[model samples]
Target: MSYKQILYNTPPTDAINPSLTTTDGTFRLSTIPKPSNVPADKLLVRVHYLSLDPAMRQWLTAKRSYIAPVELGAIMRGQSIAQIITVGSELSSKFKSGDWVVAYSGWTEYALLSAKEVEPFSVPAGGRPTDAMSVLGMTGLTAYFGMTEVGKTKVGDTVVVSGAAGATGSVAGQIARIQGAKRVIGLAGSKDKCEFLVKELGFDAAVNYKDADWKKQLKEATPEYIDVFFDNTGGEILDACLARANRDARFVICGAISQYNTSKPKGPASFMTVISQRVTMKGFIVFDYAKQYASAVQELGSWLAQGKLKRKEHIVPGGIEGAPQALVDLYKGVNTGKMMVEVAPVSEALPSKSKL
Candidate 1:
């Protein structure tokens, strides 16, 4: 049995520029032997979509972080929506073949997943199963928990979100409004994204950081103090928000994409604002609230069903080969919404497990 896979060759010192490592290669797309056997507690799955995330960049670096770096020659680590092709004998009663599941299936076309590692999910009515990988999946869940639990946003409070056009930020800004924020403002890199955030996603206001007068525009948009700041791009934007933070503000640091690739990371220059404003700032990882995933999913799904929540996906077509460029594009801010790689289409008929 053989399947295609993208292997992480080594850590990227700067960024994922394929040309810089073409000789030795930072990531290699190759076809290799598939799993011949699955343990009784494992299921064989065919990956249909691979999630493209900023965190993938950090995972490629050989640094100490919440998770281990991808090992050389190992399949690139990625969250994926897959279908169970062959159910292990012991797991037949729980999950049968053709059941859709989500897992950290990496960049392989097929995978052997531990029963504990995969969760069976039903595709939403009139929605693609890939939706479960984006807005209805971890991205949405991250926004839910980060905004509500971490930010502790209150009614009549002004909320500001960075990376407003992205998967988590777009949902975070909307959730804040749903949670009773008086005003919701977003900061994006481009004018089109700013328009999408305000017009399409229902953000009260959006600021394009690319403009020379963006700081002035942000200050004008947020006339009242910022009660909750959803910090996604933490370098300059976080500092700017801190300067305008209201007394006793809440700052939820979901990600720091601006500093992810920096060789020399530095803290915000306006650090004293936290003390002066008595702001509560906390950083969190989505996995911390794994037990509450169901509740988050239910709310997000309901929002999606009622059209209260809108989602967009920039899907790059190609199987495993497209993953590398897709990852680089994510960091370059080429995607307007949730970015993903379409590995294959969802269908009932798929290859069965191959026995050794």
Candidate 2:
């Protein structure tokens, strides 16, 4: 059976600040041709969901980053949930037909990948793999490693997370709390978001950066000073956190969503604070800790299974057609949690023995 897929066009001139028109884009949903002969080592998956991340915005731009920019006319790069439709070898016995899996399938309905390219999920019988893509996947791993490893959070430490209501930030704050933080302070863009951080997500304190007295509020909220700063939105908020850091504080710079669209990236103007406070600021890419991913996933999965952690995802359904705008929404802070677009229904067919 054939499937529909959306293909991206030429890259935008102003990829940093992409608009629908300037991006020179098109949404081509056409039938994907089947391979003449399926490779003996490849697996075919029917994608069910596409994750929309802030990082995607940065990837669209031809900038120097840990990862290379998405080439023009290529499928937009993304992480997604898929079901194994066909397997190519017995060596791929780790998965089977009807098995739900997660893969870097991009924004397409049907994805052809190598067995090494996909991670099989042992969903609870009838559960979906989207759960694997969200709570048990990259977003979870990002929060786990970025918080526990990079931040080096300790019990009784005052942890502050910028963009605290976002996908990574929200999970990071919870992880800090689970690590026995004295106080978990969340900084979000709006009052409602702050409310969600405090009430729904169990953050000890929530401050809205939009407040006129945001600096004062941040200061008041963390009277003991921030010991571990998990920064998702850089710019003024980062500066504020820097100004309020305790001695030898750990600042985990995960992403700078605030600067992604700006022609010029803005950071803390003062290094004197870093010197005076003796702050140890470091940036990390999630892929850097790939070796520890299985351990992290296991721990996070246990937490999730035991109800010690909660996962949130703002799901937009419409397959590949919804991916681009969902990315735009991610930058706009319109999504409340882990942002993802459901592309298609999970496949029910099992892989053939020869294919496997």
Candidate 3:
């Protein structure tokens, strides 16, 4: 049978305009043959949702990094929620057909993935398996590890989160509160996001960075020094947080979305603060804590079950064809929470119910 796929045919040059430039090319829908001979360790899956992450922009570059860049003519890489439709004979009993799973399925309707490359997940009561792609998935794990390990968040400490309304930042700020933070401050782009952070997500205070007096607001919100700063958008916000950091404060740099698209990256102007306060700023990749992912998932899942932690997803409807635009929207900060693309209707494999 034939299926639709989005191949990364274009590369971003000056700025990513998927419609006009190949620097980040537009989605190309194509028909491809199904795998006839299934390998013993491989499985066939039908993708339901595709994660739209800021990291995808970096993946398009040919520069050397921790992970290999996505090559031209290849499927755009993304984590997806899928269902195992066919399993190899050797793995039939281990993983049967119709099993929900999470995998690096890329931008396609159907995927032939290695069993080892995918992880099986159970749908929680009153929740769908798509939660595995959001709060209880890589995004959650990134927050859990970054806050606990790198940030070293402690009780009674004042915590601050940049990109506070976004996926990982929202979770990080909430987790800090649960861990006994004295105050949790969130910095977001718009008034609505700031309101969501303070009113809906239970943040102590929020600052709208787009406002002219945002710096004054940040100082007022964080009267005392910030103990932990979970930075997702590293730019002036990072510098501001650094200036107000307490002695030996911890800075967990998970992402620098503000600088991802820029040609000449700018460092924080308050570089002196790093030495003056003797702060501990560290950058991390989620894969570093892979061994303890299960423990973190169990804890985060429990929070979701008890309604202690909340999650929101900004789902863009359209299959592989919409993948390109969804990515652009993510960079533009149009998505409120976790940005995702609906590759197919989840109603077929699993219904979208109360999500994590």
CA lDDT scores, all candidates in order: 0.86, 0.80, 0.86
lDDT of 2: 0.80
Select the stronger candidate by lDDT from 1 and 2. Answer: 1
Q: How many pairs of residues collide in each model? A: 0, 5, 4
Stretches of candidate 2 above 4 Å error?
A: 13-23, 26-31, 34-37, 89-92, 124-128, 346-356
Model 1, backbone clash pairs (residues 3+ apart or across chains), number: 0
Clashes of 2: 5
Model 2 agreement with the true structure over 1-106: per-residue lDDT tens digits = 5666655565444333223344456333457676655567888887878888878777767778889988766777888877787777754666676677778888
Please give the distance, in angstroms, between residue 256's alpha carbon in candidate 1 and its true position after superposition.
0.6
Give per-residue CA lDDT, model 1, range 214-307, as digits (tens). 8899899999989999988888889999999999999999998888877787788889999999999999999999999998899899988888
Instruction: Summing lDDT over every window of 10 consecutive residues in candidate 3, give the lowest-scoring window.
Output: 20-29
Candidate 1 lDDT: 0.86
Q: Can you tell me which runs of candidate 3 are displaced by over 4 Å?
A: 20-27, 350-356
Every candidate's CA RMSD: 3.5, 3.4, 2.4
Candidate 2 global TM-score: 0.90
